[model samples]
Target: MKLVVAYIRHEAFEPIRLELLELGFPSITIIEVKGSGRQKGITEQYRGSALTNYLRPKIKIECVVADGDTQTIVDTILKHARTGSIGDGKVFVIPVEQAYRIRTGESGEETLQIHPDAAAAAT
Candidate 1:
């Protein structure tokens, strides 16, 4: 299995989620995060004061899929998340040693599949 982690602009979350769902990759975990990379954060003016080195808000989307689906998922995220500018964010693919569905004790690839039948069986 592979875990695809994508850090994307906050505004891109909904579009990315919808695209992923259309692609049959509906199982995702989203986290609101703040960080900066090559863009090195940004400067903003508040109350006539300059706020420097402020971490930008980003959405982190994590989806674990069978190894074969990793690239497709990554592409979907990139397509939906890109804005032709810096701070557009990045995606990382990590190898998952194992995964377990706590209820049914399903492990490995089965743990990542999202299906009504499978979910019911897991309980």
Candidate 2:
């Protein structure tokens, strides 16, 4: 299995989410995160005071899928998230040793599948 983690601009979340759903990948974990990359951070003016090196707000989207789906998921995120600008974000693909669904006790690749019938069966 592979875990795909994408750090994207806040504005890109909705589009990327919709695209992922359309691509048959609806199970995702989203987190609000703050960090800096090559752009190092940005400076902003707040109440006539310059705020330097402020961490930018980003949406972290995490999905665990079968290894074969890694590239497709990454491409889907990129297709919807890229804005042709700096701070667009980054995607990291990591190996997942295992995954478990607490309610159904599904594990591994089965935990990543989205078939309603399979879910019902698991229960």
Candidate 3:
């Protein structure tokens, strides 16, 4: 399985989540986060004065899915999150050695029962 981590602009969270659900990725975790990229935060004008922007608010969406669905998931996130500007955010994929559904004691890929084809496609 692969873990897809997406850090996106806060405003785009709801839209991205809806898009993900439409693409069959509904089991996800969303969290509020703060960070900056190459541009390093941003500067804004307040009351006719420039205010230093050190950290920006962002949303982090995480989900584990079948490897075969990796490309689709990434594409979906990028398509929905792009703003044609800086701080649109980024996506990261990592291998997940294990997972578990605490309620049922289901483990590993079984935890991600949402994607039924993951195991079959893995081999």
Candidate 4:
């Protein structure tokens, strides 16, 4: 298994979420975060004074998927999150040595996807 983590421009989250869903990746964790990257934040004017905020707001999207699904998931994030500019954010693929679905006590790849029965029930 692998964990795909992406810190994306906040505006990019919605579209990214939709595409990932269309690609059959329905389970992901979303976190509102703030960080600095190569772009290093922006300077703005307030009360005629320049203010520089070093931390920019971002949306953190995390998903654990089967090993074979890693690249496709990363591509989906890249396709939607790229703005062709700095601070479009970063995507990291990390090794997931294990996973366990707490509610169902399921482990391995079985814990990564919404079971067919559970999905149908939600619909």
Q: Which candidate gets the maximum TM-score versus the true structure?
A: 4
lDDT of 2 by residue, 14-104 (tens): 9888988888898999999999878785778999998887588899999998999999999988988988998999999999999898888
Cα-lDDT of candidate 2: 0.89
Candidate 4, 1-123: lDDT as tens digits: 999999999889998899988888989999999999799859999999999999999999999999999999999999989989999999999999999988888999998878777989999
Global lDDT scores for all candidate models: 0.89, 0.89, 0.84, 0.92
User: What is candidate 4's CA lDDT for residue 62?
Assistant: 95
Residue-level lDDT of model 3, residues 1-123, one tens digit each, is 999999998888887789888887888999998887875956799999998787888899998998888898898889889998988898999998888887667887767765445547856
Best by lDDT: 4
Residue pairs with backbone atoms closer than 3 Å in model 4 (clashes): none
1-123 per-residue lDDT for model 1 (tens digits): 999999999888998889888888889999999997888857888999988875888999999999899989988899888889999999999999999999878888877777568669979
Identify the superior model by TM-score, candidate 1 or candidate 4: 4
For each candidate, what TM-score against the reference?
A: 0.88, 0.86, 0.82, 0.94
lDDT for 76 in candidate 4 is 90
The whole-model C-alpha lDDT of candidate 4 against the native structure comes to: 0.92
Regions more than 4 Å wrong, model 4: none
| Cα error of candidate 3 at position 66, Å | 1.2
Residue 49 local lDDT, model 2: 95
The predicted structure with the larger TM-score, 3 or 4, is: 4
RMSD to the true structure for each prediction, in A, is 2.6, 2.8, 5.8, 1.2
* Cα displacement (Å) at residue 92, model 4: 0.3
